[model samples]
Target: MKFYKISKDSGKKIFHFNSNFIMSRVIQTDKTTNIGCMHLEEGGVIGYHQAVVPQLLLVIAGEGYVRNDKDEYFKVQSGDAVFWEKDEWHETKSDKGLTAIVIESVELNPSLFMPLKK
Candidate 1:
């Protein structure tokens, strides 16, 4: 499996990717465990999508709203954290901007997703 060193800052080497929304993965784990950070631009909205694996998102900066397919929604701001599981449909919106840290862990085998190398 692949491993990446976690850093507090996004460096020039960081790869940009488009998931539910445009995001930059800071540190990514190729094992069952994963960690990452993302910057959501102002007025950005992450479309409804299911994560490939279970994840936890912690708001690091800015404000936003997270919505699920079940019609449930929640306001998200700095210092808030949300749990996301594989195959669970959800979306996110940022009226201003948002920076978040995401973490994930899988019990079974995992796949590697390195940005830019593809």
Candidate 2:
């Protein structure tokens, strides 16, 4: 699994029309892709499982913990993005709550567009 940052801190500023805003580029896929929004309520958990395809999870709100095959959990919050390889074991959970955007595909190469988390 790999972790990255997609927050405004890593985005480009747009000054179009005299308006200013930061746009974070997440990913681009030429192959079949699946995108969805995930909402984990307080004490919610996405049980450990093998990823059907390469998966990327972008935290848009709240905070949570993510674990890989080693079963060690790491804290994740808004602006964070987690990437799991095909068939990789992983899980996500939150004690309070969290919201995220999930992207799944075989052509994902986030390193081309996102900055890796330190």
Candidate 3:
């Protein structure tokens, strides 16, 4: 699993047409893609399993822990994104509640866009 930062601090400031805002690029895929939100209540867990395709989990709210094939858990919070390659084993767990947006696709390549977590 690879960790990336999608927080506003890593975003680009946009001042186009007298508009002020920050844009954090997520992903661009040409192949078929699936996007969904995942809500985990306290002590919730997404059991370890093989990723059917390249998967990117973007934590939008709350905090959690994620593990890859090595079974080492990494803490993740809002604005954090985790990527797993196809067939990679992974899992997610939360002690408190957490909400995330999950993106899955054959063409998912987050490294090309988001900066690695420092």
Candidate 4:
């Protein structure tokens, strides 16, 4: 068992993130899952990218907009959760700054649910 406290100063910034935004990776487990936190200042944008695995973004502070491959945008705020399937293209932006929790899992698969349908 493990416990972690989320803090801005806890993790290292992701080198590939846009300069206007800050992304910190807090936890990684055996190449299967990753947990991170991101902060987007006003006018900041996270460039479009395809998800390598299933992901969930949980907005914890402020507000922002998420853009999908179809060019559609969705407004999100604190307590809002967004899910992205593997290989889905998406991006994010914030006009008033935003903070969120990011969770990704490469090993999660449909097979895991097969036994639950019983």
Report every candidate's CA lDDT: 0.67, 0.80, 0.79, 0.79
**What are the runs in model 3 whose C-alpha is more than 4 Å off?**
1-30
State the lDDT at 72 in candidate 4. 82
Instruction: Rank candidates by TM-score, best first.
Output: 4, 2, 3, 1
**Candidate 2 structure quality by residue, lDDT tens digits, 15-37:** 43332334455665566787666
lDDT of 4 by residue, 1-118 (tens): 9887566666444435344577777878888798889987788777788888997788899999997798889899998877788999889889999999888997655344333222
Query: Model 4 RMSD to the real structure?
Result: 5.1
- What is the TM-score of each predicted model, taking all chains together? 0.67, 0.74, 0.73, 0.77
Task: Report clash pairs, candidate 2.
Answer: none
Instruction: Write down the worst ten-residue block by lDDT for model 2.
Output: 14-23
lDDT of 3 by residue, 20-64 (tens): 334455565566787666666687677777899999999999999
Error of 2 at 29 (Å): 9.3
Worst 10 residues of 3 by lDDT: 14-23
lDDT of 4 at 17: 38
Candidate 4, poorest ten consecutive residues by summed lDDT:
109-118
How far is 115's C-alpha from truth in model 3 (Å)?
A: 0.7
- Order the numbered candidates by lDDT, best leading: 2, 4, 3, 1
Off-target runs (Cα >4 Å) in candidate 1 are 1-21, 107-118
After superposition, candidate 2 runs with Cα above 4 Å error: 1-30
Give a tens-digit lDDT track for model 1, residues 19-96. Answer: 334455665566757666766667766667787778777788999999867777788999787777777777777989
Q: Of 1 and 4, which scores higher on TM-score?
A: 4
Candidate 1 lDDT: 0.67
